[model samples]
Target: MSGTSAGAPEPEGALEPEGAPAPESAPGPRRRRVPRRERERQILDVAVQVFAKRGYHGASVDEIAESAGISKPMVYLYLDSKEGLFLACLRREADRLVGAFQGAATASGASPELRLHAGLLAFFAFVSEHRDSWVVLHRQASELSEAIAAAVAEARRAVMAEVADLVRAGIAEGGPATQLTDEDADFVTHALVGAADSLTDWMARHPDQSPEGVTLRLMNMVWVGMGRVLEGEAWKPVTG
Candidate 1:
C-alpha cells in the first residue's frame, strides 16, 4: 500500500463512542475562567457606568467587558447575559442606598425632624457620591426590564415606608398641626419621595450646584413646607 493511501477509517460512532468517554469539547463562552465574585463586581461597576451613559438597551455586553478590562466570554461566565448584569447592578446600588439610609436612621437618637434631616443628608450625599450608580438605578434600570423596574419600585416603597413611619411619629408629637391620617401619610410619603427624586434629577442636571447649597435649599423647602402644611397651610397657584 502506498504511504499516501487513505488512513484506515475508524469504526462507526467513532466521534462519540457509546458508554465511552467523549473527547472534551473546547470551552464555550460560559466556560471561560473568571473570578466569579470579582468579575461580577467589576462587570457591575462598568455596567452601571455604561448603562447610565448609554441606557440599558443601547449598551452592550462587549462594551461592558471591555470597560472592565476583560473579554466578553469572561463576562458571560460571570453574568449569564446583559439583563442579568443590569439586575445585578440595580440590586447592588439599591442595597447601598437603602443600607446607608437605614444606618443613618438607626444610629441617630434625634427627633423625627433630625432623623429626616440626617437621612436626607445621607441620601443626597449618596446620590452625589454615586451619581453613575444612582443614574443606573433611577433612570436606566427603571426603563429597562420589568425585573429591574420592580426592583426599583420595591426600593422606593421601602424608603417611602420609612418616611411614612417618620411622618406618623411627627404627627403624634406635633399634635393636630402635624397630625396625619393613613391616607395623609401615604400621600405625604410619596410626595416627599417625588420631591426628593425631582431635586436629585435637578442636581444631576446642574452639576455646578454644590452639595451644601443643594442640601440647604432642599432643607428650607422640605422642612419648612412640612411645618407649614402641618399648620394648616399650603401653597397653591392662583388662576389668572
Candidate 2:
C-alpha cells in the first residue's frame, strides 16, 4: 500500500480546479486612520501618563512613542519635541480643569455660595477622574525645564484668577455686610486654591472618600469662615 495518509486528501468542496486562478485569500482587516485631532489627543494622553509616572527627566520620547503605538518621528511631527509634547499635555489638562471650574461656576443665576460649591464639586470630580493629569500638572511639570515651569505657572495663575473672580463676586453679592477688601479677597483666593490643591493630594491618598464629600468638607471649612468675615467679624490672635 502507498504510504500516503488518507487525511491529506482535499476535503469535498475544498479543492479548486487545476489551472484556475488560485482563490484569493481573504483580505485582512483594514487599518483605520485616526483623525489628526484624535491622534494628537491620543499622543497627549499617553504622554501625560508617561510623564506622570516617570517624571519629565525620567520619561523619554521613545518610551512615549512606543506606549502610544506610534513612531518617534511621528510624535515629533505631531508635537515638535519632548518639551513640546509635555507642554501640550500640560496645556490640555490645565484647560480641561479650568473649563470644568468655569462651567460649573457659571451654571446658573444662583447665589455665589452655590456657584462656589458647584465649582468645588467640579474641581474634585476632575481630580478624581484625571489623577494622572493632576499628577503631571502638579508634581512633574514643576521639576522640568524653565519653560515648562513657566507654562505651568501660567496655568496655575489662570486657575487662581478664576477663583479670585468668584471670590470677588461673592463679596459683591454678599452686599455691604461682607466687608472683604480687594486685598482680602486676593488673599482668600490664594488660601482657597492652596487648600484645594493640598486636599486634592490628600484625597488621592484616601481614595475611599467621594468627590462630593470632599467638596462638602472644603465648603464647610471655607464658607463658614468667609461668612463670619463677610459679616464684619474677623478672627484675632489672643493678646498675651
lDDT of each: 0.72, 0.80
TM-score of 2: 0.83
Q: Put down candidate 1 lDDT per residue, 85-202, tens digits, no spaces.
A: 7777777788889888878876777688777767777788899999998888787766666776887898888888888888767766768545557787677777777888888889
Q: Highest TM-score among the candidates is held by which one?
A: 2
**Clashes in candidate 2: how many?**
0
C-alpha positional error of residue 203 in candidate 1 after TM-score superposition, expressed in Å: 1.1
lDDT of 2 by residue, 118-226 (tens): 9889999999999999998898888778988997899889889888888888889778666678998999899999999999889989999999999899988988788
Off by over 4 Å in 2: 1-32
What TM-score would every model get versus the actual structure?
A: 0.77, 0.83
